[model samples]
Target: MSEKWDKESILSLSGAFQTCRILLTAAELDLFTILSDGPKSVEDIARDKSWDERGLRIVMDALAATGFLQKSAEGSYSADETMLKLMAKNGSQSILPLVLHRNRMWESWSKLTEIVKTGSNPNPLGMASRTSEEVQDFIDAMHVVGSVMANRIVESLDLAPFKRMLDVGGASGTYIMAFLRKAPHMKATLFDFPRVVEMGRNRLTQHGFIDRVEIVAGDYTKDELPSGHDLVLLSAIIHSNSRDVNRMLYGKIFRSLDPGGTVLIRDYVLDESRTNPPDGAIFAVNMLCATSAGDSYTLKEIREDLETSGFVSVNLIRNGANMDQLISAEKPR
Candidate 1:
């Protein structure tokens, strides 16, 4: 390592959660959206948002120091242009929903110690019993993320040879839209939960893809996947499942494919060390806090499970910026 690693670095790592909490709190308070109009003094913002002036000022200054906001000589703070575009609620490229979803995960993360001790999440209803609004937020957050990443993922693959695709657990049809936009001849079946399939219907219609895509509703864990597709996409799904669950899913995908069909998985495919992609390592902890047996996996584990499911010719397609790597395997003819 060229850079010096020391105690200060460890201290900084320990304090990193403070910055995360600050950003999450700011998103929850809609601070960036509030600042979208223009600069605002502490008193003005606190009064408008009905927050304590002193505390709001402190947080605003913290955000300014973090380069998310700019502090003016007039002692007012404003969101930076990037922040306005990406973090504001109504901005064209807004990721506010994703930030808000993280805010929802705050409570689960707080129980990390307990989860580690018990080998299970204490909150049984954390994901299962989410309120409708919470579910919408979660799904919308996935849409925001998927919309941004889908194009890159599509471009990374060669879809010309494939005619039909099944996007297992496809939420809101983000990847399906990307694929259809890239390959006009390709048709997709988006399979997700019933409620999520409803959202996908609206989104696909809005994207002018309702005619090209078939929306199916089912739980991949307990349901049979729709068959006869030449291609199957397991986008962002495996990380939330246990090894056995994933093995079972791979089998379902294998059976669902046409002869010599391909199954593509987009997830955090960690390297052998399980640390090359650092975000996947940290996200494993998120899984620990949120699910009973979810964790990031190494490529070896993935290949083994897929091969055991009777798939062959497994290979990596691309590695993503945030551990969203693409791995492809084939159901032998």
Candidate 2:
């Protein structure tokens, strides 16, 4: 046997899976937060958290060996500096919920073989056999995912001239809150299903943006969309459904906007050739497993959709994180 193992060696797949599960389980258990204050021995840490000492010790040692923690000479363990950033509840830093949500996503992905064989979404849509709460939970999960980028999106957008921005399908008001923090002069109407609106309202209230954010409760597809906003922000939403619905939504956005208004969309966009962007390629399969018609679209595909819906000029900006692209279209005056 070779003393040094190849990083890309096929034999390491099993170890990689175990490593990911341990990291995810630690994040889900708030272990990072618990360790943020100071270092602790395995027994004390386990006793404090009511965890199994032996199991926690094994996990901690594995993480330390993997460089996520440091084992001291005194036999206590401390979180690595990079891992501490993920423990923050506020600021632009929370990765705990995002990591936990992904762990849940892994369950659906484990049945990918079944999904491919049947060509059916492993995740149930709100339509059949699923309760309203189940649907809301799915939406809330997306909300958590979206929150990760809310801070960046809010700061990046030029909201100086815009008075009221409408966040279509904006779950939990995370985007609006981030924007409100920057553009305090602007108010936002968060439009979504009634259940989502309730969740957003609760979040807005908690974030102290209740006065600046208005909740508009209704189905955006069937009902009349809230009108007269200078800007419409649809982050991580357009790629969630069929091409037809995406085009239809763009048309509605154009109509809902005042003349020369802007519509901003952020999501994983495939390259113009419909290749190269590996994240978009993988995200396409995730949509296959999750939604009835959702798949990540290419930049060319999205630009065409915007033009067909009446936007004269469309611009695409590729942000380096997670292969996400932000496209902006302006309603012709």
What would the per-residue lDDT of candidate 2 be over residues 1-333, giving only the tens digit for each residue?
124656667678656798898888787677778788889899898887788998999998998888888999998988866788864333146566567657766776787888889988756443234466555555556666666567766667677888989999887887888888889899999998876788889888987999988899887678767898989988878767789999889888888999988998888877666554777777878777667788888778888999999997788854644745688889989
Can you give the TM-score per candidate against the true fold? 0.89, 0.77
Leading candidate by lDDT: 1
For model 1, the stretches where C-alpha displacement exceeds 4 angstroms are 1-4, 39-49, 65-67, 70-77, 124-127, 319-321
Task: For candidate 2, give the lDDT.
Answer: 0.78
CA lDDT, every model vs. true structure: 0.88, 0.78
After superposition, which runs of candidate 2 have C-alpha atoms over 4 Å from their true positions? 1-14, 33-57, 69-93, 124-157, 181-184, 206-208, 317-324
Clashes of each: 0, 0
Candidate 1 C-alpha lDDT tens digits along 1-333: 134779999889888998898999899888888988988999998887788999998998999898888999999999878888999988989888888888978888889998878777877433357887787888889998887689988888788999999999898899999999999999999999888899899989987999999889999888999997999999888888899999999999998999999999999988898775878888988888877788899989999999999999999879864856999999888
Give the per-residue Cα lDDT of candidate 2 at 130: 44
